[model samples]
Target chain A: MSRLQTRFAELKEQNRAALVTFVTGGDPNYDASLAILKGLPAAGADVIELGMPFTDPMADGPAIQLANIRALDNGQDLAKTLQMVRAFREGEQVTPLVLMGYFNPIHKYGVERFIAEAVASGVDGLIVVDLPPEHNVDLCDPAQAAGLDFIRLTTPTTDDKRLPKVLNGSSGFVYYVSVAGVTGAGAATLDHVEQAVTRLRRHTDLPLCIGFGIRTPEHAATIARLAEGVVVGSALIDQIANATSDAQAIDGVLSLCSALAEGVRGARA
Target chain B: MPANRAHGALLPSFHSPVENAMTSLRTGPDANGLFGSFGGQYVAETLMPLIHDLAAEYEKAKLDPEFEKELAYFQRDFVGRPSPLYFAERLTEMCGGAKIYFKREELNHTGAHKINNCIGQVLLAKRMGKKRIIAETGAGMHGVATATVAARFGMECVIYMGSTDIHRQNANVLRMKLMGATVIPVVAGTGTLKDAMNEALRDWVTNVDNTFYMIGTVAGPHPYPAMVRDFQAVIGKETRDQMLAQEGRLPDSLIACIGGGSNAIGLFHPFLDDKQIKIIGVEAAGHGIETGKHAASLNGGVPGVLHGNRTFLLQSDDGQIIDAHSISAGLDYPGIGPEHAWLHEVGRVEYTSVTDTEALEAFHICCRQEGIIPALETAHALAEVFKRAPNLPKDHLMVINLSGRGDKDMQTIVHHMEQQEQHA
Candidate 1:
């Protein structure tokens, strides 16, 4: 089984929600980002989402957009990002790591080579924002053949007719974008998410992880109870944004990650 | 299957030998929205449903006689349709090669071909019960057109423009405001046309309901390229009729500047199967292609996905869209229309570039010789005309689509004029 399957199975047995943490591959610089990646599992991240920095992140809001700018300004690229993942794998084995970003860079990097290198470098899954089910034959089919999970996003606007096409070749987990707005904007309402999750449950057996607006630990904990997993991204990147130096960025991100870890862990207990 | 939508699906990929070429080649985009592997709706999923809805509405409206009649009335009374086709005697003599004619789209009310598309789209927006109309513009021509239509129909209007465009084309910006539009200035990613488009799309996703995004150019998801082309084909249709009446024959060639390629495609689509009439498209080369600061996508760019379509664009190695430079604000965008990308590939039209200096010379020459000051965007096409005309025989008739007037270009022209004075 893939690492995502194994990790999700373990989380199922544990009878608690998974805490998925997201950060850019190299937010401020290489060494500090690597240090944070190595420590994410211990800080309570069941799945680590490493963002491949892109220039035109149209779907993302202001905070994560700034994080992408910071990573690129620090000279991050696909090679260095893969190196960071490979280095993180050296110390840990069980936790799943997914790479997320737009599709153009992968298209520019050459798709077959990117999938091969991503698999070799220990990437367990992918979530390309702009690619839809109609165009899934471009990357999803190939990545699945390479034994990597391809996560698909469902929005609040996804009706019954469109949900099946979205869930057709999806694996690992289904991401429920709780808001119609861009990433990192604000939290989603509980009633809307509850109804959405119930509707999605009738369609697929895959684990549903809700993202897009969950920022604080309390918000994450509340969202954790409603779904199989909760994703925290912009709020953690906000830690890096407020830091004075690379050291502070690394410490600030992990420290907040630990606090969010506690919030999600304590929810069921 | 609906009439227009289903017919669009059944279109043949290319022209057949026996078919009258005057009938358009709508075989493009297929069901997957691929115009011979160039155009597709590659936008964020948030906007997908809205785009599909608009396309369906447009399809229905295309077949509705009432909608066609309403649009025709608007075009005739509001936009001044059938803008004159005039012989340019001085220009033809000066070029010394081909007999020159001008489509005179500049004489249209509000002074460009942009109002033609806006009137068609806004009428559809009303039929679909959309209360708000939003658009993005680089030169502010399309913005003013959208605002004018919105005021006419009593719908709320908003326009997104880049900060640099707002500064240079302030006259049109004020004109848009006077027509009851809220002008939002975008200050992201080089603060130009591409940036303004990005900001407008951002607003669209956030306010999906009650809002209709009227893309100014031919480059977008399917139906837009085909729909906009159909609306503007009035230029080519009038030219055909006028030439038949006046000169007793079709012109040998046609020329138009391409910024997202609306005006050029508008003039070229009706004549696609003519087989003998030559077609040319001129792109702005801001500094020069070699200097790496031009908006000449066919000359200097590669195929990539941007602004909801896979088209030719100026981009970095990592697929990040690079800022395009042009003396004309309207042409300072990274990508050309997807249909233009396919047309370039098929060699149906010859694509070339005119440097900023070359277009400036043509602008002055048009003023001195023809007593007409063309927009810097149109000046690029005039420059190409001057180059090719001098080499052809004098009897070879060539018609150019003078896409817009020069009133909005005064700031850029004045700045260049003062710089020349300082240098002298």
Candidate 2:
């Protein structure tokens, strides 16, 4: 089994949802971002998503957009992002790490070379926001072939008719974008999410991770009860955005991760 | 002849739905909305089903006689279609080599070729039962055009423009407001066209239920490039008939400016299968292509995906999109349309560049000699005309797409004149 499968299976055994934490690689600077990445698993994060910053992150809201800009302004690039992943792997290996961003950088990096480097660097999965199943031949199939899990984001708009197609080649887990909007937008109603979760359960057996507009321990706890995993991205990036010093940025992210992970751990109690 | 008055108007060929044969180079985006690997439905999964629905609706609307009839009615009565193909007599005489004709898209309802796409999209929005329309604009010409069509169809309109563009294009801002559109100024990423598009996409994703994102250019995801091209192809269709009627044959060459390449594609698509006819697309070289301060994507950039499709983009070695610079806001985008990319790759259209200085000179010449104040974007094409027309044979007929009027560009032109006077 892949690292994602292993981690999720472990989580299922524990009868609790995984707390997936995301942060842009090299945000504010390389050392600070690396510190946050290394501290995540120890701080109770079950899965980590490292953002490969690009200039244009179309689907991101204000918080993540600023995060991308901060990361890029500090000289973050694809090679450096992979190096960050490798650095994180040197200290730890059990927590499944996924690299997420737009597709242009990977296209420029050469898909085959990126997959090879990612696999070699211990990166476990990918969550490209702009790549739907229609262009799966471009990256998903190839990445999965190389042992990197290709995670698909199924949104409110991914109707029942299209859910099968979206989940067909999907591995690792399915990210349920609770809203039809961009990242960091308002959260979906619990009723809406409950219905969507039930509807999606009919489509595939893959673990479903709910993301978008998820912040605070209570909200994550609420979602944790209904899904296999809970994703927190913008709220944590907002901590980095609001931090005045590098140390404060690292501390802010890890503390929040601990609190959210505590909420997910005690949700079923 | 009155320059703005279109004469010898005939029913445009688009009124009839003709199934394009497979052999024609005009047929593209086979089912999947790809222009030979350049265009595809690369948006998020949230938009895939909607895009598929749009593609299906567009296909049905094309074959339905009622859609065609209504589109033709508005084209004639509302958009004032069949914009004249005017002979640029003094420009031809000055060139002293080729006969030059202007496909007067500038005289269209919103004073640019943008309305041609806006009309068709607004109609589609209405058919889709959408109550609101959203679009992104650079120089605000497209905003005004979209606003006009939304008002005509009685729908709520919102336009996303860069804050920098809003400051430069205050006149067009007022025009959009007058038409009841809410112009939202985007302040991200140098506050330019690409930034505005990002904001618009966010808006579309959020309001997908009742909102129709009417992309202004030929650049976005699948079906958009092909659909916008079909609507704007009236220019090329009219040019073909007008050229044959006036000059007894098709023009030997065609020239047009390209921002997202709607007007250029509109003028070039019908003539794509005409093997003998030459086509040239001019991109804006802000300072110059060498200065790394230009929007000449094909000449100064590489192939990458941005704004929902794979195309030639001005991006860094790290694949981060480099901000494009052009005096004309419309041409300041970092990427070209996917069809233009495919055409450039296949060697079907010769893509070139014009410096800001060269375009300004052409703008002034067209104003003085032809009494036509061409948009800075259109002047890029006129500049290319001045370069190639003088060297061709006397009987070598050339048609340049006058894509827009310069009424909205007086402020930028005045600023340039002031700087020149200070230097003097």
Candidate 3:
């Protein structure tokens, strides 16, 4: 079994949701960004989604967009991001690392080479936001063939007819976007999220991870009770945005992740 | 994929609604909304349903006679149809070679070719029961045009423009506001057309229920490239008839400037099957293509995805979109339409570029000699015309789509001339 599966199984046994913490690779700079990433597991991030910054982050709100700009301005590219993943793997091997961003970087990097390098770097999954199932032959199938999970997103507008098709080729956990708007723009109601999770459950046995607009520990806890995982991206990046210095940026993100992890840990109890 | 086609539609479609599986690579944007391996619905899942609806509606509307009738009525009376195929006698004599004709799209409503597509899209928006219209503009001509159509149709209008464009084309910004559009300044990613498009897409995704995104160029997701091309094909259709009427034969060559490639594709699509006709698309070389600052996507770019479609883009090796630099705001985008990418790959239409210096000279030449104050965007075509026209035989007929007027470009022109004077 993959590290992701093993971790999810262990979490299922623990009867608590997984805290999926997201941080852009090389935000501010590489060393500081890597430090924050390496410290994620201890701070309670079960699954780390290291953001691959692209020039145009269309689906993202202001906070994540700025995070992308910060990362890019600091001279971060796909190569350095892989290096960060490789560095993260030096100590922790069990925690699954997912690279999340738009597909152009990976497409430009050459999909075959990217998937191989990512697997070699101890990366477990991919959440290429812009690549849909229709264009799966481009990235998803190739990534999966090279032993990486190509996670698919199920948004609020993903009607019943499109659900099965979206889930068919999808591996790993399904990312349930709680709102129809851009990421970090609109918060999803617990009632809406609960219903969405239930609907998605009928389609696939893949662990449903809800994200988009779950900002606080309360928001995390409320959602943690309903899904197998809780994704906190923009809120965590907001920490990096609010910090005065690089060290404070890492400090701010880790502290917030620790709190959110605690909230997820307490959800079942 | 064939099951996805809209059934029993009336008028002929731009494409025959091919299967999405891409069984054959002969034509483009198959049922899956792909142009060979280029275009697709590379958007958030929240937008899939909406994009599908748009594709279906556009498919149906293309077949419906009422839609065509209304569009023609607007073209003839409101926007001004068949904008004169003027014989540029001085330009031809100056060229000392080809018999040159200008397909004067500069005479269209709003003083540019932008109104051609906006009218079609606004009517579709009305048909879709959409209460709001949103558009992105680089030159601000599209904003003024969209605002004009929205006012005509009684729909609420919002236009997203880059901060750079907003400052440079302040007159058009005021024109949009005067036409009742709320212009939102987008300050991201080089603060240009591509960024403005990103902002507009964000707005559409957020307000998908009530809004119809009126993309100014022949770019974006599936139906948009095909739909906008179909709307703007009026330029080519009229040119074909006008050429047949005047010269009794198709022109030896046709040229139009490209940004996201609407005007070029508009002129090129109708002539795709014409064996004798040669089509050329001119891109903005900015300072020059060698400087890595131009908007010549095919000339100086690689294939990548941006703003929801796979196309040739001026991006880094890491797939980061490189900011495009151009004196002409309309051609300042970093990417071209997906179909242009496909057509370029297949070697049908030739893609070339003109520098700011060359375009400025062409702009002045057209104004002084032809008495036509062409837009900076249009001047790119004129630059190419000036180059090739001098070498060809006088009997060799050529038509250039003057896609817009230069009234909105005085500031850019004045600014450039001043900079040149200082250097001299």
Judged by DockQ cut-offs, the docking class of candidate 3 is medium
Clash pairs (backbone) in predicted model 1:
B97-B394
Q: Is candidate 1 or candidate 2 better by TM-score?
A: 2
Residue B135, candidate 3: C-alpha displacement in angstroms: 1.0
Residue ranges of candidate 2 with Cα displaced over 4 Å: B1-22
Task: Judging by lDDT against the true structure, name the best candidate.
Answer: 2
Retained true contacts (fraction), each candidate:
0.39, 0.89, 0.78
Local error of candidate 3 at residue A22 (angstroms): 1.0
> Candidate 3 on A22-126: residue-level lDDT in tens?
889999789889999999999999999999999898888898889999999999999999999999999998999999999889889998899899999999999
Worst 10 residues of 3 chain B by lDDT: B1-10
**Could you give candidate 2's per-residue lDDT for residues B1-424 as a string of tens digits?**
1211221231122322452243456778777778887988889888888888898899999998999998998988988889999999999999998899999999999899999899898888889999999999999999999999999889999999999999998999999999999999999998999999999999999998999999988999989999999999999999999998998999999999998999999999999877678889999999999999999988888989998899999999899999999999999999999999888876778889999999999999999999999999999999999999999999999999999999999999999999999999
- Residue-level lDDT of model 2, residues A15-105, one tens digit each, is 9999999899989789999999999999999999999999989899999999999999999999999999999999897999999999999
* Model 2 clash number: 0
lDDT of each: 0.86, 0.92, 0.90
Model 2: fnat (fraction of native contacts): 0.89
Model 3 CA lDDT for position A165: 87
Q: Compared with the true structure, what per-residue lDDT tens digits does model 3 show for residues B1-424?
A: 1211332241122343353223332345679888878888898777888898899899999999999999999999999897899899999999899999999998999998899999999999989999999999999999999999999999999999999999889999999999899999999987899999888888987887899999988899889999999889899899889988999988999999999999888888888755456778999999999999899998999999888899999999899999999999999999999999987776667788999989999999999998999999999999999999999998999999999999888888788789888999
lDDT of 1 at A203: 100
